[model samples]
Target: MPDHQYLLTLKHILDGLGRKGGLEDNLNGLLATMARELGYVRCFLAITDTEDEDLKLSLSYSPSKADSVSYAPGRGVVGQVFENGETVVVQRISDNPNFLNLAFGRTEEEMARLSFICTPIVSHSRGKPEVVGVLSADLVMLPKDELEGHRSFLEAVASAIAHQVAILQEELAVQKHLLNQGMAGLPEAQPPKNFVASSKAMRLVLRQARQVSPSRATVLLRGESGTGKELLAEAIHAGSPRAERPLIKLNCAALPAELVESELFGHQKGAFTGAYQNKRGLFEVAHQGTLFLDEIGELSLDAQAKVLRAIQEKEITRVGGEMPIAVDVRLICATHQPLEDRIAQGKFREDLYYRINVFPVFIPSLRERREDILPLAEFFLEEFSSEYDKHIRRISTPAIELLSMYHWPGNVRELQNCVERAVLVCEEEVIRTYHLPPTLQTAESSSTEISLSFGEAVGKFEQELLVDALKKSRGNMLQAARDLRVSYRIVNYKVKKYGIDVKRFVNSKSRKR
Candidate 1:
């Protein structure tokens, strides 16, 4: 191979990375480019799992039998390169004992004519060269001199794409972390106070919040209403160095448009009809602390200008006064509205948008993070039960199913209100399906439940009723049958049909009493 061909291959790899596509697609595109430009039959990119220290195949030039395959450190040639943080070249695949041939399953004849080269993709983002992944390719056996040069070229390509590969590795790490947790697993780590992050989406949001908390960079929280943008802003503030100082919050939309400037920047005495005395604005009040502006998109163009000036200059002028007051305050803005659309409509300033979007963290809606619904519901249940002086202990199975299945359009706020309403009307210790709002019980809301047929729904309800009766009767079939207004034979048949464990309910009753 000529030196120009190697340079051309590198150029093609760089071009492929710049194409518009997902990380996986772009990475696989790189592999495809390598296979086409350099006469290689197969190319693979394997990412190292941060938690488990295993090499998992992430991208392939051609479809292979390695979708589920992984190599433990030092287990195979790929693993050896990853473990040693060095490139490995096998002149002939058959000659290398470390070549496990587990991923591709190539025949013995094909192995005889192939040469292998594996290079570690090292990242220096942390100020140290660390191997994050491995890139390998197969080629027809080349002259020894040319083979050495090709190996160096492969190393160069690996170095060039290390940063991108590291980003992909971080994403994979987050996903693997989520998958390792049981579907219903309780959160083990205590996140910021009052923060519930049992779901993957919330965990990701929390991670972003924590990472950006230390910096004075402006953070824009974007999400639908009731998605806890304000809560997240508070979390970010509490984790920052400004935690000891005041965290002033202002709802930009809640204030009257005329009073928005007065509320934000304060007004000198007699500045307006309502300004009887000079009042310090939130910026001055939040000196050396943090200011959280909720519904920032609702700010008028004039207010946006002043806010942007304050952020850029780290100073603010009184509503009616000219002297600029220096304020050392970190800014966090939250908005459910699309700022981009607001800018397009000429309602918002583009410069201000860019400034506040320095570190934008999108808070996912409740529907997107369904795993959090139960935990959040329970949290609210405990709070409302205490406030109302009730003893609501837990949500019933049917109620849990309903809560999980419903699409919470209003996000956490709506869920909180729903749970509070249930607590107020729930007379029993356990909240049942009937206690939930009727909106959640609607056919449209619960459509995600496998599009349950009429008979299946009825049978599910019957089984729940039977289980409830058995719990009340301490698993006494005849007593439960009487309580449910059914005969013992029918109750027995339903119990068998639903796979109800009567003994467990009896044990629960015994423990409760």
Candidate 2:
């Protein structure tokens, strides 16, 4: 029962399918046939949708009973399949407590005696490894002699089922094909030039985003206001195969309750007052692309339901239109508030939070990544200076020092505005300390909360921040140094002064100052 031998036999059977009942029907019939032949009591085939909205259970055949039931992806064995892209083979399904039983009227003990095996079907269409759906087959009350043969047989049968599923979708003539191209571990393209992130905090976010970009998972972007959630959404969309297509952005909080639904789900002509013509909303416009729903934490419970349905069903019903319009769009959502807390308070739906938060990326506030403050200030100064027709060389060292010391609660957006305002009014080529906002100079002079000496306080804070960055970077010494905006020698000196193990943080992955 080697894998290679089994595969050859499978190819022969596929060649034979051309002459059977019908191409498509023969395929399904053979799938079930192989299931029973493999000494299984029943078989089930669940296929994940193109848009990855949810898994559609297509076949369920149980030999013991004549009846079969279809269940949702998150409801039964398929739920486990959707959650983890691995085979769930149970020799005794009833014995396992984690086995969320879907086998009708079967006790845990009874199910345990009946060996179970489930394989996740990774569709070639997406070209990414994921639990697209599952194929479940089991043997009832095996006495050990038949168990070995049954297990081997089911694996071969599972492979056959996967091929058939792919072919079926191909034959269906899907107008919008889900592109299979992308870095299996990275984005399809580099990040935006304007979307700057040299700091470790932002780098970590980028890393997480890339890791989940290729998979069929809903992305939940959590951050404070003006923390570049929309920018991150754009990065995700741009780095996807759908990059060439439209990126539909919806400010969920910007629209009123009366119009939010219509703005997102579209409405027919005369669906409501001011519906002068049939207007497609953000969702419809971004078809075959990405839909970034900003401020999702603000969505009403009723609005939350519609959004969840659109994600779960891969189809949306317009405000007035009864017929469901199937959409092929990847969803990337962003929110400025803590959605989990909101869910607890009942302001946001728990179900929607879970649905959208398949992969969550947290954008760190500017205060957390203070290393980027000076660079960001300079970049903005250059941008605004050029726009305003000024020849601003750069900020003076004292001015940059002042800018760096300020705790920007308003984050990068605030820094950009500050730099712009300063550049517009400044006279000299070198932006001086006086040109900076008064708050910055005040913060630089007396922002120190600790009563320790000037050097002592800075030393203590820098050492602690560097250590935290090292831990977050998984002991990458170079990354830690770069994150702290310090030289390698300075980081090494601190390591020795603090008696910290230098070898522990050895993986260097960043440039020196």
Candidate 3:
């Protein structure tokens, strides 16, 4: 190949890497481009297995062969290049005794006529260079004079591949670190307060939280019970400028209607039967800070009127006191009940609802963001493992499937309790399905017993079958269709109808690579 052609081939490979696809797809494209441009009869890309210290063939390109192969360190020319972190070139395979012919299994006569070049894909990490993989190709039709040029070209290609791999490795490392931090209850800018926001719904919630955090906006967090509204409120306070100040929390539903005003607006000395001294209310304590009022919908009508007056005036009069004391407080309110319905029933004041609902943030339930289930489970597992003094490493695959399939009606709080219980009952390093609550197991069985029309049942079965097939085929629709003994068109139509994201079935490791 000419110098210009070599440059073009390198450019093509780099361009493919920039495209939206997994590492394996880009690598296969690179191999095919090399073969088409340089006339290589066979090409192989192998990376070292860190655990086993062996070479595993990750990709292979050949016109007549589809076999995947591996090599032990120093077993063949490919292994030798990787082991030595240097390039190897054999002008004629017959002349080089080191050529093992392990990859292609070419006969001795065929091998004698072939020219081979193998180069180490080396990367610099922490100011030290390390061989990450081997890139090798065989030239069966090129002249001897072109052998040196091709060897240099292969070395250049190896350098490009090494650069791409290093970038991907760095990204994977960052993801692993972030996941660890989340599981360990560390804060991150993207998700906020160790919350898992992998699903689009949760991410939108995070974005809103971040946007509203810097201001003094009164945020009303709306979500079902156990949807982590308190966590979200804390996240907002933590992100706010007044984060250093105290964040006073009160549950209106937990307090009696008679004491609500005293709990919120403070009490003068001898103001009530239980009051022996002057007592500061949450509003006064949270001055220049934040006050998180949970179950706001449960506030009594008189309490609501007083709360509304305090919010509007930015001042509160102590219970049984005539004078009002000024306060500067950021308010965050949460309620699972619909305040509008409460207003219709004349249980809640509309004015107070609008006052607290100025900046509403709706947190989706766990069942709504199903994609986040596994991450949240892992996070809870880590927390519970530490709490129980156990060395739980992971959740078993069957347990994961069970957790994912179940509808979490009680949301994150429920998940946290379930994981804690599992950790207490678990005996081994892994959390198995048996360790989970009986309710989870019964959930799956209950799902199957639901009443449905024949058409609905068949559609459900078809969707499940297609999903299983796609998972088995690693998101390859054509392969999934073939596995199901159906036409590709039908499979594609059903995939769209069922709103499936085929890419989700693809191996996440492949994308990270």
Please estimate how well model 3 matches the true structure, expressed as its whole-model Cα lDDT: 0.80
lDDT pick, better of 1 and 2: 1
Collision count of model 2: 6
**Cα-based lDDT for every prediction:** 0.85, 0.70, 0.80
- Residue runs of model 2 more than 4 Å from their true location after superposition: 1-189, 444-513
**What shift in Å separates residue 173 of candidate 1 from its native position after superposition?**
7.7
> For residues 1-513, what per-residue lDDT tens digits would candidate 2 score against the true structure?
355654555665566575534446765665566554444567767666646546655556665443344445655555766667666656677665666655445655667578777777665534565454577776676555555555565556665556556645433323223234334433443456566675657766776665565565679898888788888887787777777799988888888987899888889999888888988877889898898888888788888999889888988989998989988778988888877788889899888888988888899888888867877887798788889988877676656766777778778888888898899889756677678777776644436443457787566655655655676566777777887788888877887887777566556433211
Comparing candidate 2 with candidate 3, which one achieves the higher lDDT?
3
Using alpha carbons, what is the TM-score of model 2?
0.52
- What residue pairs clash in candidate 3, if any at all? none
TM-score of each: 0.63, 0.52, 0.54
lDDT tens digits, residue span 465-490, model 1: 78778887888999999988889999
Better of 1 and 2 by TM-score: 1
Q: What lDDT is reached at residue 361 by model 1?
A: 92
* Deviation (Å) of 440 in candidate 2: 2.2
Alpha carbon lDDT at 211, candidate 3: 64
Colliding residue pairs in candidate 1: none
Judging by TM-score, tell me the better candidate of 1 and 3. Answer: 1
